[model samples]
Target: MHNAEIAMIGLGVMGKSLALNLVDHGFQVAGFDLNSDNVARAQQEAATLAAMPGKGRFLAAANLTELLAQLATPRVIALSVPAGAVVDQVTDELLAAGLQPEDIVIDTGNSLWTDTEVRERRYQGKLRFFSTAVSGGEAGARHGPSLMASGDPSAWQYVKPMWHAIAAKVDADGMPVGPFDDGEACAAYLGPAGAGHYVKMVHNGIEYADMQLICEVYHYLSEVLAMPAADIGQVFARWNQGVLNSYLMEISADILQTRDPETDRPFVEVVLDKAGQKGTGLWTAVNSLQEGTPAPTIAQAVFARAMSSQKTQRITAASLFKAQAKSASVPDREAVLDDLHDALYCAKLAVYAQGFDLLKTTSERQGWQLDFAAIAKIWRAGCIIRAIFLQQVTAAYQQNPALENLLFAEHFRTELAERATGWRSAVANAALQGVPMPGIGSALSYFDALRCAVLPANLLQAQRDYFGSHTYSRTDQPEADKFHLTWNATPRVQQAQ
Candidate 1:
């Protein structure tokens, strides 16, 4: 039997969208899923799209054996299953099916990067394992998505054509470039082993911060300004016209504009406050802490989600401690709105700074030769966090690849400085109005901490030494030297070395 070009397992939403995208690129695709219904649906969808220009053939496989049989020698299979043990389970099944050593297996899910590393180690010699973190959601999957692929060079070479063909492309202005567009695709070999997943994790972490900041702005507008949802929706629409223009911001405006048919109320008003998470954001936060990377903005965003999940406890607490008066007097509505925009933009700078800083540290530790510029370029279009500002970021890295932080980039640094007053005013007003702005608040704190030349950590160390005997370093002493002082009055006011 003649083999197909590629095969995708697990025909769920993302999987099916990807399969169709592959088909649209003129690659014959074989798709399989445990559920016959999904396979049948995929077949029907593919058949409908067969008339489109560049459309390729689609084959539905009933089982693993059939799926393997349909693929050519040196088969390239994509696994879009859930993360965790299930990924390993599928890999073992493929290995057991007598697949050749050179065959390629690509995992396209939000699995932890560490797990990807382990999987690569375990699958060594048995088969070539690679991972690609896809962003842009279902629509992205079907059209174009930002792809971050990493693994063996040989395996990447085998799949690079498809990756490039299906990924989003952007022109010089960061506008979406079509399949026929004259621009580079938003896909690249990130690094070795788990670098792709790691970069993707960083993307999601920044997304959490971006989303939380927007929510804070919405909360302040709703509760403090008492603005109608439609009016607030208008504000988001305007924000999307400026540097804040992004996929997430665009959706936020849409969500606010949407009305509920049941009560004719704004859909957002009827939606529950409780938020759900799938662990990627938490993983980013935890990894940042483990690496001793200062990522308060991302960490605070994760904490905000955790705080949101306590809907029941919050309801009870609200009744016990009646709402307080506004934290501060509300300024003129127009003035406040302008300040809020600058505040949000400034906070966003901090979020990306922290996320990229984390990525830099991880890349160094893992020996991954990451291209920060390429990463930014990919995120310029297809990702959830794609923003016009990303174009500037890409430029910043291109100008200086060893950029320490986004805040240090001349463009962002100067902009943040110019926006400082408004940022401060927004955060202070939020506090005065009794609105929680953990994400923005943490960002401001991180910004301040970064600029501080000397912190009070010296005193903190002294206190720690006084109580727990933790050694303290003196300003006059080298970093390797440690000193301890006895706070209690005993004899020579004891000093220890």
Candidate 2:
């Protein structure tokens, strides 16, 4: 739209909220949605707002023609549609409707980075493409959402004020834990088209892992201490005051504390233990595997949810095996809570570390200015998994923007050293007592990956050298670039020289 307000192509919950935010920021906005209901709702919401003091009002275009007529040829239309083929479908349709390459199309959905990569190529030098991951869901979308966007750096400047107008505030640690009450909340550019989605993908992946670890902690309490949900929640609430303080953990406590309206019993029992997973968590696990990243906890969390989906089979099978609700003799509640929290804190760090490592690796391979510390700050505010530790991540990035990896950072090293022992013991205990602590195992894996001196695959070195004349390094002299190789015996041959 020639010097017009931001236009939205999909006016669903997220789009509507973003549109309203634009309106609130004094941008004369125009929107179009396939669903008539959403279109009508936008109109209704617009009608309820205070009369514009001096700006133009928001309009819901009746059709593509109407929307095109309202905006400039190279429109700044953001798509909040579903990811995958549908995104491409909309882009193609918009192109057919005379949307020029000079136009800007922002995909504010959780599209795979690959999609963004492809779209960038397909658009070539014509249109601009941005893969933006919008966080904060329904509520955050309206007031403010942490925006991770990547595209033409020049075009980025055009909408930056809008991003600032809508983002959450960052803290001293550079994390986003709240809306920018003073006008600096959640949004920032993440580099290029696919960069935003890639970062967001990792964010969700970490979220998956973080939530599972919290659940595992609860599992340890319920099985070992026979503690009820509320009591376990109290333990988490206490942890919230320390290093483990986080949005997910805090919400978990709220869920447990919530009472039923009818029975006055806990509302958790009323809700299904069987949680359903959308594909992003699983996609993240798959991405990690393909990229040779250590994402065990997130992968396990995805699997755990899948297993939860088999409720009917699980219920039926419980009858097949005669089992007692055996309770392990728990240590003192205070002691157990402290130990578990120490374990949880370490595990959570490991989880974030693993994810950040992946980002570092990805940024190196691809050209994305990840700004790990900035990302950590953004995660702090507008997302589902906002935690206090993200500040550390942000600071780490700010100090060394080209930080090759996270574990090598000095402060992180100190933090890990202090908490890792207890975390390791927690995992060992879980393994010893048959506790399913995938999150802890993942956390352990982070330490293992960062140790540099040892690797589980090192045992295969001899075998590696035996077959292909491949070389192997000795643990004794790792700092030295020396490697040992056992060449396969070859038939006697004269030297070519």
- Which model scores highest in TM-score? 1
Q: Compared with the true structure, what per-residue lDDT tens digits does model 1 show for residues 88-146?
A: 99999988877778999999999899999999999999999999999989998888899
Q: Candidate 1, which segments miss by more than 4 Å at Cα?
A: 327-330, 489-497
TM-score list, all predictions: 0.97, 0.88
TM-score of 1: 0.97
After superposition, the stretches of candidate 2 with alpha carbons farther than 4 Å from their true spots are: 1-3, 52-56, 72-74, 171-180, 316-330, 464-497
All predictions: root-mean-square deviation over Cα? 2.7, 5.4
On the 0 to 100 scale, the lDDT of residue 294 in model 1 is 91
